[model samples]
Target: MEKKKRFGVLLCADDSEYVKKKYGGYFQVFVGLLGEEGETWDLFRVVNGELPNDEDIDAYDGFVVTGSCSDAHGDDVWILDLVRLLRRLDSMRKKVLGICFGHQILSRALGGKTGRASKGWDIGVTCIHPSPSNKLLSSLCIPSHLLIIECHRDEVWEPPPHAEVLARSDRTGVEMFRYGEHMMGIQGHPEYTKDILVNLIDRLLRHKHIQTSQAEAAKASLKEKEPDREAWKRLCRSFLKGKSLS
Candidate 1:
């Protein structure tokens, strides 16, 4: 039998040791980044554990960092370790993708900065445009007015010296970027399902991002709109196949 390609999924959040229910969080982002690549999903690291060391990376084809509740600017040791892991992945030319906090870490690791961004949270869906196309896009440029779910308070302020900005939104110009060749980061939660986002919005009720009523209203509206399965498949295929760019 042919060997199945393996990949790494690391979580930066502190998911209390025991999960009361089987649901989303880092797992959701992992599936989003992967989007049904193969029958058996290969996750290297569990949620809320120590980041893996250098030699550990050889076990996977690429790495996917999940969004964390912790801010990238904070002095968390684990956070720093993940950043180091990112650097190693980039140097090795392995595909690296970050979502939300994942996005901030990628930028900061590449000599950029992340903090209590001047831009506030983009809780609901927002339109994104591909500013600069790449080979992965499959020769079909999406409409400039595509709506994607956005949910990050800490935005990526800049891309590294050699990194290029791939997609942007009116709210935050650094919504998406490509570092080096295959490495990429997205501020928006492209992997988010409407149901999951709704639950997440409710989970973050304590935060002053969006009002409970507003989030609830948005959730109701989302039920009517269909999830962009094509976009999900395209991203997954492009990254796994190593043809990402456009």
Candidate 2:
């Protein structure tokens, strides 16, 4: 019998009540998108200071870093620890994927710059154009413009040294990037559904993270277009699973 493929998720955010009740937390959400049959998925809540031990790092075939409510540039203790962990992953050349805050933190850990977006928060579906410079991306046959669900205040200003930028959008320059063959980062939420985004928007308004007008505008933008969920899933899965486009 073939050995089962193992994957780990470094969850950087605490689950919201709705997510916890409906999906059993963000881990399930990620697995729902990326998990394959006969594969084992594990979770480490980095938000609560949980991480895989160094000795056990090689046990998984790949790992994913989830989005967070905190800024990637902050000096929090857990953030610093997570940075160190990311650096170690890079040195190992293990397959890794990052989303939103995870994307920013990965850039920072790899010697890139990340900070608050100059244009303010981007909280709706936005179009991203993939770069043709990367051979893998070039062969994916993705459209000239791909729409994705984005909800981030921070953006990657510069990618790490030797990293190939895979995609970009009007609001954020580094929508996606790949470091070597084993690592990738994306600034949008492929795991999220429209309902999740709408709930998050309401929470942002309730907590004053965004104004009511801003929230309304974000909601209005969603009606214009939907995210290219299947394309993103295929691209991300191919990269993480080391599959090639035929």
Number of the top-ranking candidate, with lDDT as the measure: 2
RMSD of 2: 1.6
What TM value does model 2 have?
A: 0.96
Once superposed on the true structure, which residue ranges of model 2 sit more than 4 Å away at CA?
A: 244-246
TM-scores of the models, in the given order? 0.84, 0.96
Which pairs clash inside model 2?
A: none
Residues 132-187 of candidate 2: C-alpha lDDT, one tens digit per residue: 66666667777889999889999998999998888888888899988888888999
- Native-to-model Cα distance after best TM-score fit, residue 227 in candidate 1, in Å: 4.6
lDDT per model, in order? 0.69, 0.90
lDDT of 1 by residue, 1-246 (tens): 966666667766654322214444456546655655563444544234556566767766777777777887776777777777788887888878777888888898888877766766667777677663465653544455556776677887777778888778887888778887667887876666675677678777857567777776667557655545467456655765467464
Best by TM-score: 2
Tell me model 1's lDDT, rounded to 2 decimals: 0.69
